[model samples]
Target: MYKYDNYDQQMVDARVSEFRDQVARRIAGTLTEDQFKPLRLKNGLYLQLHAYMLRVAIPYGTLSGAQMRLLGDIADKYDRGYGHFTTRQNIQYNWIKLADTPDILADLAKVEMHAIQTSGNCIRNISSDQFAGAAADEIVDPRPYAELLRQWSSFHPEFDYLPRKFKIAVIASETDRAAMKLHDIGIRLRHDDAGAIVADFYVGGGMGRTPMIAPLIGDGIAIDHMVTYTEAALRVYNRHGRRDNKYKARIKILVHEIGADSYRSQVEAEFAHLQTLELEPPAAELARIQAMFVPPAFDTTAPDSVDRSDPDFAVWLDNNVHAHKQPGYALVTISLKPIGGIPGDASADQIRLMADLAQKHSFDELRVTHAQNIVLPHVKKADLYALWQMLEANGLGTPNLDLITDIIACPGLDYCSLANARSIPLAQKISQRFADQGRQQDLGELKLKISGCINACGHHHAGHIGVLGVDRKGVENYQLSLGGSEGADTSLGQITGPGFSEDGIVDAIEKATEVYLVKRENGERFVDTYRRVGMAPFKEAIYG
Candidate 1:
């Protein structure tokens, strides 16, 4: 992880001071809700249906154990003693009081973390693969470039206020773990024929009421010109993107309306102009940033094998453990989605425990995944059994990675003002419906996502079995979809027939999975079966 310099520290300190005053005036009744709306939003504060929610950015989903301890402290001392890890790899604290936010920001600043650009019509947090530097299959670590972009985009004068919120994601591996194509700007980092690092650009991908997979705009932009080309792309979108209606304000809609070819032409034109200005950073600075992300020291113990004597330990080893680049080590995912528990909620004590584990077992670092899980990216394989025991005792050791029980759901009506129905309870009920470990394992690699509304914060649009909540004539209703994916073979799901009530949605999911069980071929995932057979049979089973 990159450490903040004096300049970064000063900027964060200044922002905290500015927001502190603004919050004071709002409480003093000098500024009304409408007046304080943008001010608070710029600072990553939102007035939700029940209380205020504060979103803190975790850049590229990387953080130190020290930073994690600070976050745990904030959660324990401030709001509700628990924090929600979002799909964007950020953390949100609900039940926030306006007066205490400045204090919270002060504490975060002490640890080089902040809520800046976590919300508002700006270039939100830049995300990368959770396993950025640790992935065994990476072509190059994408975090150095991501950190460079973070410095370039933060409070840029030209893009301070875009037409809408913009997102950018970078991935360097063959597998698309970051869902890069589903971002406003997705950069694929790879080596060219000459083995030089290059970035392939994809523009205009997003999900909301209108969803789109960003089209490829440029093919081999040299690493040196990454920032320059990005400037060109954002300049085009900022200049021509829709501003009249919030519904059509995202760059994805602009690309869809103007056509990809025309948009590419405009970006190329802008690139031609930006190149003359020599906008890229100095080579030394880039090298310095890259050096910070170099791989950590590995112990030479190099054990020959892992102990999986216990049945539960073997299951966890199979589900939660991922291959690591270092010998005798593995990347372990601490599943926040314990069966019948909230998907991404980590209690303060659990957070502290993870920090302690990372400090002792790993190399004092951890990563947050876009799937709402935490990764100890460098755990020794020999330690798996002991780690599982600790995590199980803390309620963080559910071995349901990519299974039906590990559902991704948003705060929904429970915390979000824009939600149409409660997503948490629905997710819980559906999780319970498939609670049997053997049954979920039999289903094989199913992804279920739920969103309370069309905002898609829950990312229902990308699930294998997606459920969406809606208000039908003042009554809460849920809609089901199938075959949505957010991986290398990314595709949006198609809606299945009419909507169902809360309980009906859970039952509908059961019926649809049963159809998969009947129709699936050998070695086929639920998504594979759905894609092969299409939606007709599942729709018939659920509706009939």
Candidate 2:
């Protein structure tokens, strides 16, 4: 984990002091709600349906045990007893007092974390593969590059207010675990034919009112020119992106209106201009950042095998464990989505326990995944059982990774004022319907996502089974889509026709799964089956 230097610490401390005064003004009636909206939003504060929600950034989804402990403390002391880990690799507290936000930020500053840029029109938290350094197949760790971009973008005057919010993702592997193509800008680092790392830039990708998989605008870009190329891309978008209509403001919309070829040409022109100005960070700076991310020391003699004698442990090992880059170690995903529970909500005690486990068993580091799970990235294989026992006791050991019950859902109407219908209840109902562990295992690798609206905050556009809640004449209507995937081969789902009532949607999902089971060939997952047979079967099953 990267530790903050004196400058980083000082900047955060300054922001905390500044915001404390701003918050005091708001509470004292010197600033009205309308006047304070943008000010609070820049600090990641939101006035939700029931209360204020504070979103804290976990840059590139990486945090240390101490940071995790602080988050738990914040949840217990400031807001509710639990916090919601979001799809963007951030955490949100649903019940927050306006007066406590500065104090909470002050607490975060102590641990090198903050709420800055988690919201507002500027670039949001830069996301990356949760398994960045730990994944076995990655060419290199992508976090340092993500951090470089983070430093470049934070409070940059030119980009402080764009036509719309911007998002970026970086991934080193081809697996696309962070939904790379579903971001405003996606960077994939790979080794070129010359055995040098290069970045492939995918621009104009996003999900919302209009969903798009970004096209590869530039490939084989030299790693040294990464920031320059990114600045060029953003300059082009910031210049021509729509400001007339908020609905048409995303870079995807601009890219769609103007051809991809034209967009690429514009970015190249901007890149050429930036190259002349020597805008790319010096190589020494990159090396300095990379030094902070060296792999943890491993116990080379650690056991490479697990006993797996206990049936429950065996099941968890199969479902939740991932191969690690280091031998004799594994990446364990602690599922926050227990059956019949909110998908990403973890209690303060659970959070603290996870922090303790990370400190004791892992490398004192934890990662928040885009799937709303936590990763203990460097756990020794020999210690797996003990770790599992501790997590199981804390209600964090649900072995339902990518299963039907391991849902990704948004706060929805339950908390989000912008939501038209409730997503949490629907997610709960669906999970309860598929509570049978055997049934979920048989289904296999189904990424189910639900969103209260078209905002796609829950990434419904990329799920194998997607449920989008809409307002239909003041009643809640659930629209079902099938075959969407956020993988190396990214694709948006197709709607199954007429929307259903809340209960009807759950039954419809069951029917769609039945179709998959019957039509699927050997080794076929739900999305694979849908792609093979097309949406006709699912549409018939769901609509009928």
- How many steric overlaps does candidate 2 have? 0
Per-residue CA lDDT of model 1 for 270-295, tens digit only, reads: 99999999899988888999888888
Q: Which stretches of candidate 1 lie over 4 Å from their true place?
A: none
What global local distance difference test value does model 2 have?
0.93
On a 0 to 100 scale, what is the lDDT of residue 47 in model 2?
94
- Report lDDT (CA) for all predictions: 0.92, 0.93
Report the alpha-carbon TM-score of model 1 versus the true structure: 0.99
Please give the lDDT score for candidate 1: 0.92
The reply for model 2, stretches above 4 Å from the true place, is none
Worst 10 residues of 2 by lDDT: 535-544
Candidate 2 at 376: error in angstroms? 0.4
